[model samples]
Target: MAREGARPAYDPAGHDTALRATLQELRTGRWMSMRRLLTETTAWWQWTRRTQVLATAAAGTDVVRTWLEEEPHSVPATVMHARVCVERALRAHREGHPHTLDLWHEAWRASHTATRAAPPDPVPWVCLMALARLDRERQWAEHRVAPPGPMLPPGPWGLLAEADKRDPYNREAHHRMLQFLYEHGTSGRLAEAAGYAHWAADTAPPGSALHLLPLYVRVERYRRSGGRDAALDLHWVAEDATREAQRALYAWFEQTFTAERSLLDLNHVAHALWGALQFTDATRLFEALGPYWTPQPWAYRTPDQGDTAQAVEIFLQARARCRPA
Candidate 1:
């Protein structure tokens, strides 16, 4: 499928070749390749890549279903099936499809089966947590359930715990937990989200991509405040929050600037820095991204304005602002 919008003037194709290759391996029921793919992607905090691969694969679930039926014990096939089902269910709910619930239920079943099939893998647990979060969001939005109270439902937490047990520093798992907390925690409690981000960054080993967690929180804050330029302005460039977030970005740049560095993280930090008017730092990150825009942070810059053109405009403007004198 052709991705909409003009490709950025730099490295387009989203640098997703690796992701496509990994999905191809999954299609062939290559369990070892699947495991290696997950391990490497997760270690590099390539959540977007992992998600894109899974969602794309889910678009062809019939083939995945056949693979699973042929090799019931194939961990790769099982987890891919679970991921594809969950993604489809989430997409259905987002699109207001009538069969959202049925798809969700099937996702739950597939996730459970994957969890049982590969007792040591964390991906299934991550899928379960994602399902729980999506379900809660759907219920609250559609059924008029009370906003999430002081305590989160235990199911998501338990699933996160299991995922953490299997992969202590799994960025994807931690991100889901963070999202759950942000969604279910008290309204207007941005500090709590910042606290979680801080703790996660501090606990992660140096060079770990977990340092990007604070930037994630910042993006969410911008998003919640209506994604206006005024929202970005309110958070001053010289503010302590901006300084701390920049520190985290610098840490990642220093210790984690490998060839395999995640483009998502690069784009996020660049966006945050641009919002803060740290043009030089933002420029450096943008250069590293080299035209591979992820359509987030940028897409969310303008509330109700999330088309490809806007994202491209945002990227071009940021790049221009950071150009060397």
Candidate 2:
């Protein structure tokens, strides 16, 4: 919610200039507190308060740097005010929208007029990821820049077909790419999916669950492209792939495993081959999947006790949002 801030009481011609100076005074180098800055701009106390709130929120050094460099035109009361906006972006990035990284980077660049220096080494993961994204965006633009002259050299993963690439953070993107290849039954896409699976498998930590979905993706792809033999080979790999070899044999492959076949398996066999289903089978399996994956009536043992009902409702809401459009 935006805090209420007073607009100008009079048509002061210097309002714009005054606002700029006020922000400078509250900046990092100026070191004046919000309260002190507000004292001098008494007529615009509400505006001062609004800036102070925002600045306090954007307090991190990286955020401050970004605010300083990127959003030069932002009418912050001080550097602190800009910092608040940066903090808001950071919070939003971690929660889901990785796109905020671009916004912050842009803001940081806007603040400073000088040619930007390379950011200091040992950058945080978020910053590193942002830079990586920027590099990709730059490479993308370069190809279009020359209008079909000589093509630019491909970035490491850029040459890979869409089906073959994966983002470490976007699990759904990986799944969707695999799903597309499966539904289409494109041999080229299958090979690409395999490449994607291998890439994800290699990059993922040992026994990481992220590998399971991709592995299953490969399994499904192989069976669809080849036959039972390919499916069997995938099962063999899945069995050997797990850190807990003993548990692998009977680990409720679908609901309980990384490539869980169905959230709610109708039978023991369905549960047993949880990681083996492909697109055609997935729909057949969804009737069972919905009960467990969604907030169906049967799963609730208690509707009101221990706040379990509320939690279940929340889970259901999330599942609803994840539902296929």
Candidate 3:
């Protein structure tokens, strides 16, 4: 961990200096750094994460498009082309852009192209799963497919399965499905999403990150509840809340490497531990987080949403309370 009492800064890249540097390069319309980084990224988890992050930057510019124009046959460029298209489509949908459908179709084509270009990679299939969120009407039969079990609503299970075939229990794949569930189910207190999260957590291995999925659902519930709650304190210390926090800490955080941990996952687990009054346990997560904090689960705790300064205040207070001996 960084020096004690150091203030944490929000970084989307979060501990991946290579990704931070690549983000800068992409901002300047350079793709070689991205190319080299992807070329060296052999792990599936890292590959998908890096591609997803890079695409967020690439979608706002012609970086990926220019890279593709220069190297039509490059598989990395091809995959990134799909990533950018998917990113653009998601953004367009979120912003209610005029050409959302066109971008979605374009992204669909790109995702398929990337799947063929990199057959064993799960990211392309994950792209398809993410797009399922756009199909609110379930125009595609696959999007309305039956769930694998009870209490789980119908969704693009096949697309998720395709990702699972390549990378079983892939983190982003499940999260994409979770996003679809949030949109598919209800406006307040997503019971189905919580069910799916618990289901995923129950089936995952002890060391898998899926153990933390339910925590995200809990945060979402709090977020959608207008960000202010008189019973919020009790909500965090509820028996179920404490159980999920301990489950994730033992099953995922303790078994996983610091490098394998996501910043948001770390923040959530720590926040959960703190909320549940497990200060000593929370301290370990805070230590692992070091100087990089993701303003999430913390921001939702306050009435004001999206205020970084307020989020940091709550985060620091929690950190101070749980300071390790």
Best by TM-score: 3
Candidate 1: worst-modelled 10 consecutive residues by lDDT: 142-151
Report the C-alpha lDDT of model 2 over 1-325, residue by residue, as the tens digit. 0011211121111223444454455455443343454435432222423343335433543444454455454333233433354445545555767777675665344322111221211112112222232332444442113211122222222212221222232333334334433433335545645555555544544433334444354335443444335334455336443322223223223324322232222222222233332323323333333334322221222234335455355443333332331
lDDT of 1: 0.68
TM-score of 2: 0.25
Quantify all predictions' global Cα lDDT against the true fold. 0.68, 0.35, 0.90
Candidate 3 Cα errors over 4 Å, as ranges: 186-188
Model 2 sits at a Cα RMSD from the real structure of 18.7
- Which model is ahead, 2 or 3, in terms of TM-score? 3
171-256: candidate 1 lDDT, tens digit per residue: 77778767766765555856666776777787788777788898888778777777666636666465865775587576777777
Q: By TM-score, highest first, what's the ranking? A: 3, 1, 2
TM-score of each: 0.79, 0.25, 0.96
Report the lDDT of model 3 for residue 224.
Answer: 85
lDDT of 3 by residue, 152-231 (tens): 88899999999999988899999999999998886457988999999999999978889999999988988888666677
Error (Å) of candidate 3 at residue 129 is: 0.9
Candidate that beats the other on lDDT, 1 or 3, i.e. the better one: 3
